[model samples]
Target: MSFKVWMMEIRVPYLLLPIILSIVGGALALYHGSFDVVNFFLFMAVLLLLHITVNTLNDYYDHKTGIDFHTKRTMFNGGTGILQKGLLEPQQVYRAAMGCFIIAAVIGAYVVYRVGLILLPLLILGMIFALFYTQIFARNMLGEISAGLGLGVLPIIGAFMVHGLPLTIDCVILSVAAGILTFNLLLLNEFPDVDADVPGGRRNIVISLGTKKAAKLYSLLTFSVYGILLIFTLMGVLPPLCLIGLATLPIAFKAASLSFTEPNVGDSFFQGQKANVQMILVTQLFVAVGIVASLLLI
Candidate 1:
């Protein structure tokens, strides 16, 4: 294959964006005096590799199960790539995924060596959750709960590993905010795949609840994060500036309204997915800013 063809097959550019964001988030954590630059980058690198592996494995499994072939399925924004377009074979994708996972495992092993055996159980749980999420078993109903625990609690554990201490209530609150934002993103992103998934026996949360009910749930969770942040701030568990995440509320509410109003609308899925990605990105930005502001002003 020509270099251009191989490049197209890999979709490396699309994959890099999320890795970049992960690195930026880790950098921000370091800026907030959470850890040294080296440890933060190492953690980010491991996370980025793990995420990519999961994405690739998901595509491989979806193809194997015929879920990628359904007619009504619209690709989730910048989707898992290989299965969405047949640019790569399923076995090839699986092999590539395994390569990424091996890399992640090496990094994770280093972390465990440095941080003690506590990292072992969390890593095992995270890997199990990722493996079962849409593969061997369906945990779609427990999506939010899984996301909260994995993204929120696990990251804090990673952070503590780097810092060599337990996380404070403030750090835990920030981690919860990250988890809620991640969960909401996943929930809304599933909207577009509802039709395709339902026929393919891929009963995701949106399909389980029906789109209308799912939209309501999505909205409730999005707004509830902000509400919880405010409460945390008032209770002195989190810094007041954490409410900076509220700036994204109007956009979220608008997206929620559209999702609710036009549940089966052809374009609603894509629209809602776009809005969810935006919400996730914006929330990350605001969270970083909020942490900085809190450190300086509060």
Candidate 2:
């Protein structure tokens, strides 16, 4: 397959999550006065590969199961349209996904050698999630949970620990905020796919809760992201500057409002999805920057 085709298969825009997650994790490390440049880069490399594996493997499985064919594709939720368009063979995508998983494992091994076995569990969990997410987890109600833990909470915590910093309450609080944001990301994206997913035997949040209830849940969790940050900051669990993450609240509120008022297939829905994405990225980024700023100011 051409490199362009491969990039499309892997869904490059989603790769930004890994980069931002890495920064959040690394920033947590920096906040605690531990900075290891080598370990940080290694951690980032692993995040990127794991993200690619998730994208490619999900595409491969979705194509095989006819999910992609039925899915109403969107910039936010649907699998990359590469395989359905016959741009890449399913086997090619699967093999590439496996290749990424293997490479990420090897790098994770080296990091484990240097850091300790503490990270091995997260690495294994991430690989499992990447492989089984589409085939198994999404079919059950566990898809959102798996995505949040495997991609969000676990990776951020692993990023923090890779710098040889001990996990603390502050690190965990930040990781949970990341996880909730991720959970909302996957949950909201599922809105457009409910009809497609039911035929595919998927039982994700939107499908199980129905769209309106799920929309309320999404709005609740979206607000909770900032709620947790605010509560923790006031309780002295997080730095005061972490409140900077709330700067994205307007975008988040707009997204939530649209979720309640707009149909899932309309332009407003797409706008809401875009706003959610913007909020997710910038909130995490602002929190990370706040951590660094706190460190510098201290």
Candidate 3:
């Protein structure tokens, strides 16, 4: 396949979400132990493959459902334009997704052997969610939570686990924050597709709850992320330097406020979609940076 076709099919840009999550995991690990560059990159490859699997499979499923056909898509909210344009056959997309999944599984198995079975739950959960997401979770108001936990929380925990140490309170606490940021990522992005998703049989949180309530839920979830960080910092669970995460509050607020104030869906909420994506990515980036900064200070 050509580079553009691969990029469009795999939705490579969205890989940023998993990339940042891996950073959050690796950085939090550094606070307790020395960095393992080889192990870190190995896990990164596994993550990228899993991310590719999900993106490809999601597009295949969405295309089959005709949702991608009817949706007014933007850069961030739509299925990768690959299938919609007939750039690749549906079977090609499905096969590619399976190929990515097998590669990630082999790598994950290797990591499990090297590290222990501690990562098994995360590995299993991530795969299950990736495979079934478009068919089941996307219809059960679970797309947002699944995205957060799979892309956000599990990666952080898995990142920390590969170092072969027992998980720390700080690791768990930080992972939750990372997960919440990821949840917001999908939560806000869903608004633009609610119309298409509803008709396509996707009962995503936005479609199931109505954008207004989903918007409020977005606010609550976004606010809770910072709230967790601040509380943990005050309790001495997180490093003082991690307060740097709070530096992102203004942008996050703008994202949350846009979700509720703008109140539209199916492409009309494009600005809100942008704000929400910014909030999700920027907040997690800062949180990971905060963890790494503490390591640097020492």
Candidate 4:
């Protein structure tokens, strides 16, 4: 397969979310005085690989189940568009996904060996989420939960555990922010896929809760995440410097408004959709920056 096509199907840009999450994890570890440069590299390697694995497998399954065929393909919602265009055969994509999964598994084994048995459940949960998310989890509400855990809580916990950091209230609060933001990432992005996904037996929050209700839920959850962060900061659980993350609220507020007023990603509402796509990235990066800054300045 072509490197260009492979990278496109892998959705390299989307992978940045996971990287940001891992950075938050690493930042949390640093806050606890447990950051290790070597462990950080290893943790990132597994995280990046697992993320690519999920993307590849999701593309393969979507194509196999005919979801991609009916999808109104967008840059964000539809499957990578590579399979639908015939750039790569189904078998090729499947094999690529499996190969990446094998590599991730190897690194996961290394992580388990290094971090001890406490991390085994997280590793296993991640594998299940990557492999069966579209087939099984997407149909139920489990999909978003899996995404939140895989993309959020697990990474921070794994990163912290690798450094042998003791869990603390501040750490849990930071990890909760990661989970909430990541959950919203999937929640907003799913709006465009409601039609295609439904036929494929996927019922995301957008479909189950209805667009209007989901929109309200999205707004509430967005504010709730920031509220919790602010509460912790004010209570002295998080460093006072972490209040800088609140600066992301304007962007998030826009995203919430877009979700409420324009829930679709068609040409008419594309700009709103753009805000939806960026909300998680901006919020998570700002939070990670605040956490890391607290590490250095506190």
TM-scores, in order shown? 0.84, 0.97, 0.94, 0.94
lDDT of each: 0.63, 0.88, 0.81, 0.80
* Candidate 1 C-alpha lDDT tens digits along 1-298: 2566344444454354344344434534544566666666666666666666666766677676666665344445324544567666678777876787778778877877876787777677666655555664443467555655655556555654564555466666666666777677667766666666666666567777887788788888778777877898789676557678788887787777777755346775567666766766676567667766766763
In lDDT terms, which candidate is top?
Answer: 2
Q: Which regions of candidate 3 deviate over 4 angstroms?
A: 261-268, 296-298
Ranking by TM-score: 2, 4, 3, 1
Error of 1 at 77 (Å): 5.7
Indicate which candidate wins on TM-score: 2
Ranking the candidates on lDDT from highest down gives: 2, 3, 4, 1
Question: Which one wins by TM-score: 1 or 3?
Answer: 3
Task: Write one digit per residue (lDDT tens) for candidate 4, span 13-75.
Answer: 988877877787777777777777876777788888889888988998989888888876667
- Misplaced by over 4 Å in model 4 are 262-268
Residues 1-298, candidate 2: write the lDDT tens digits.
6888877788889999989999999988988889899999998999899889888988887787788888778888778999889887888888899999999989989999999998888888888987788888988899999999988899889999999988899889988999999999999898887777888788888887888999999999999999999999999889779989999999999999888755554588888989999999999999999989988668
What's the lDDT of the predicted structure labeled candidate 4?
Answer: 0.80
- Cα deviation at 69, candidate 4, in Å, is 1.6
RMSD of 4: 1.7
